[model samples]
Target: MQEISRVFDAERIQWASATASGHTVNSAEAYQATGVSDLLPRSPRQLVFVECDVLGLEPAEVCDHHNPGDPGYDRQPQEYLQGSSLGQVLSLLGKEPTHEQRIIAAADHCLTHAYRGECPGVDPAELADWRERSRAARFGLTHEEIQMRIRIATKALERAERIKVG
Candidate 1:
């Protein structure tokens, strides 16, 4: 969400609850939450719906991989599955996925599988550290703690050496 906001220079970042299935949010609900009305004429103020179904919007406006029949889901490469949304958004923004972003995609899909060579050239220790951080961030963290974690991770990445193996 933060990445999307940064790319679009979005004025606001809002969170919307997923629908009954817990896999996706209703497009209408998401738009409402974001204060984007489909009825309004399209303008420079675009609403790029990430990981949500498109109810009354064009396919180009959405970046998701959860619904099989939806254009967003169909556009994703089969191997990436759940992890494709971020890459899709990055591609749409004319940016390549960074190594860390690739790691994030692989981790989101399946960390264990990713460690077993799916995400080649990435260090397992780094992956494990990310897993720990993810687990820690999943519950009971205040905003300050989250910010602290982000800062620590950023600093660690800056100091870390990249290692690639065949």
Candidate 2:
């Protein structure tokens, strides 16, 4: 079991019985100093989205794992990102991804490193040599295409950052 610092006073939490999707589900309860009770989200997708939104990440950054166009698309969320601080927090909350969520993340891995040309390992000159031996396998793009995608993804990321900052 993993423990996390209390978002509120430790005394303010409890286990609450609930039902979700017609199935019995357990929920975490948080009580305010005033004695008001709140329940955390039960769905993994909603939990992840809330965390990503709170972190100011673009939807695509966290939710691009299941894109149909990715060459290596396998419908999982990017494994690497899920190991980050945000992901760790989610894990502590028992809001881990479902099988479909994992698949979505897997797809994002391809889009970020391959289609968007944002990965450090992507080398235009040696693409053919490493294409099949890499996570971005068979995701080779022409130098011009890579450059274009890099520019686009960068601009979009910049825009998202600006939005976050503002």
Candidate 2 residue spans exceeding 4 A from truth: 1-89, 108-110, 114-166
Tell how far residue 30 is off in model 2, in angstroms.
26
For every candidate, C-alpha RMSD to the true structure in Å: 11.0, 16.9
Q: Report the lDDT of model 2 for residue 145.
A: 62
Candidate 1: RMSD over Cα atoms? 11.0
Per-candidate TM-scores read: 0.52, 0.20
The lowest-lDDT stretch of 10 consecutive residues in candidate 1 is: 31-40
- Of candidate 2, the 10-residue stretch with the lowest lDDT total is 28-37
Instruction: Tell me the TM-score of model 1.
Output: 0.52
